[model samples]
Target: MDVLTTQTLSGVQTSIEIAGTVAFALSGVMEAARKKLDAVGVCAVASVAAFGGGTLRDVLLDRRPLFWIEQSWYLWSVLGLCIAAMVLMRAKHFKPTEKSMQWPDALGLGLFAASGTQIALGLQMPALIAVLMGVITATFGGVLRDIVCNEIPTAFHDHHPYAVCAFAGGWVVVVLHYLGFYPNAVVAIGAATVTLLRLAALQFEWRLPTWKIED
Candidate 1:
């Protein structure tokens, strides 16, 4: 795309990342509260969900001392958010929805997948490995959230379209890059693809088929 479109793409990617972080973090905290988890549990789940995927990707890619640790600001930002959400939630329990949060989870999932894949490609990681890292970075936190709360790891199951969304987003970035799209455009295209597919999948009840064994 042209310079303006590329710039717009970058903005979209960044916004999605921040929003995804906030949305997932909020989800973790809200769930924790619903389960009657303690304050520490609430904060821990929120923080972990916010940064867990990035941390795992950084470690896999051998990028230290990790994304949130290196940046530091993300920690504070998450903390501030948890505090605000806690106050609002204590006043009254608010359930998360697409209308309120505007699908930050899907948005963030796409961005992280694109971002992780790009960083891996830059480091010369194998394309397959890079895509795996992208998905891990995009969804591991949600997986951890489910596990910590004693639920099935959502990404590991056929419960919803979440994993496919992240995977499609990651692949979009890789495909666009191969087609000579710049990092910015590729990132936006990937995010949009993931988010769109995810929402569509939900609306239409699309899902990967479960294996069947005939006796």
Candidate 2:
């Protein structure tokens, strides 16, 4: 790849990461608000939700310095976002609903899925591992968020396609890259595919088969 192409890919990935962070942070804010948490609680929850999955991925990949630490600006951006969101919610008297959180969560799922898979691929990981990294990056943060909020992780219990969507989308990234699609295009399409599939599942009330135990 040319230097220009590499730089462009980096830019696209960074943009996706930032957007995913914001989406996850907003979802955290909504969840914390639903639990009626105070300012410190809200910021802590949002930070964890925004960074947990990516941090875990970096650990698993043995990437030193971590993504957020290497890109220290992300920390300040998340902090600013949390403060602004809190101010707006209070000033507008915005009542958060569980439903409101899902939209941003879906968006974050897609964005992180693509970025994570691409990053793993860049490291020459196996395709399967890359896809799993994508799934982890997309879903683990929400798992942490829900656990911190004292609820079952929606991805596990909602009876809807959550991680499944990320799984499929991760394959999309793998296939596109293998087919020689440009990095930016691959990322965008993969992310869009996951986000649309998730939104569609929600809109259509799609269900996954649930386990039934005999009483």
Candidate 3:
């Protein structure tokens, strides 16, 4: 790859990562509104939901200058969005339904899934491990958000193929990378795969079977 091409690819990857952060932040804000949290609590939850997974990923991978630290703009952006969301929630007629955050959650999941896989691959991690990292990167933030909000994490309980979507998208990224596709193309395809699969699962009520030990 040309030097300029590598720089361009890095810029694109950064954009995807930022977009994912924003999506998760919005999801957190919606959840906080549904819970009727105060401004401070909402901001706290939104920041965690926006940065928790990536922070964990960076720690696990021993990537220094953690992404949010490197891009402080993400924090500022989340703060601005959360402030706006709080104001919106103050409207007497405002009410967020149960399904309000689905789109942003799904989009964030896909983008983070691909981003995680790409980073792990860059580190020469095993394929399966890379995929797992991708899934963690995608879903862990939501887990933290739910935990903080005193709700069971949807990824663990929903059984709606949430992590499965991330897993599949991670593999898509891995396969594309092995096939010598451009990084941007790989990220796009993988994210799209996850996002579309999640939306379809929601639309069709697709689910993973539950385990039952009792007869």
Candidate 4:
């Protein structure tokens, strides 16, 4: 890749990461509020939700410094977002609900899926590995967040196509990149595809096949 192309890809990835971080942080904040956690707990949950998946991805990929560590502002930004969300929700007498949390979670899932797949592809990983990385980056943070909040991870139990959406979107990213689409456009389209698919699934009550173990 040319220097210009590399710079553009990096910029796109950074933008996607920022948006995904904020979305996941908001989801975490809402979940924490639903759990009636204190301010400190809220911030801690938000930080894990914002950083956990990416941290895992970096570790697996052997990327230095981790993205959040290299971009320290992410930590401060998530903290500020948690504080602001808590204060605003309180002032407005808003009750955080499981439904409200899903919106930001879906958006974050899509963004992370696209960004993660792109990053892995840039590293010359195999297409399957890249897609798996994207799925992991998109879903693992929510798993961590739910575990912290003492609940089953939605991705595993919801019977809705959560990581499935991310996996499909990752393939979209891979295909677009392989077809030589513009980096930014590939990311945007990939993210939108995943987000829209997830929202649609939620709206239409889509279901995955589950074992019908009789009690």
lDDT of each: 0.78, 0.86, 0.84, 0.85
Whose lDDT is greatest here?
2
Q: What is the per-residue lDDT of model 3 for residues 94-204, given as tens digits with 9 covering 90 to 100?
A: 645648767766778898898788888878999998999899899889899999999999889877799999999999999998999987788789989999999999999
Q: Write the per-residue lDDT of candidate 4 for residues 65-170, one digit (tens) a residue.
A: 8877876888889888888888888799765566876776777888888888988998899999999999989988888999999999978997899999999999
- Which model is ahead, 1 or 3, in terms of lDDT? 3
Would you estimate the TM-scores of all the predictions? 0.88, 0.88, 0.88, 0.87
Candidate 4 lDDT score relative to the true structure: 0.85
| Model 3: residues with Cα > 4 Å off, grouped in runs | 1-6, 9-19, 95-100
**In order, what is each prediction's RMSD in angstroms?**
3.6, 2.6, 2.7, 2.7
Backbone Cα, N, C clashes tallied per candidate: 0, 0, 0, 0
Candidate 1 local accuracy as lDDT?
0.78
On the 0 to 100 scale, the lDDT of residue 132 in model 2 is 98
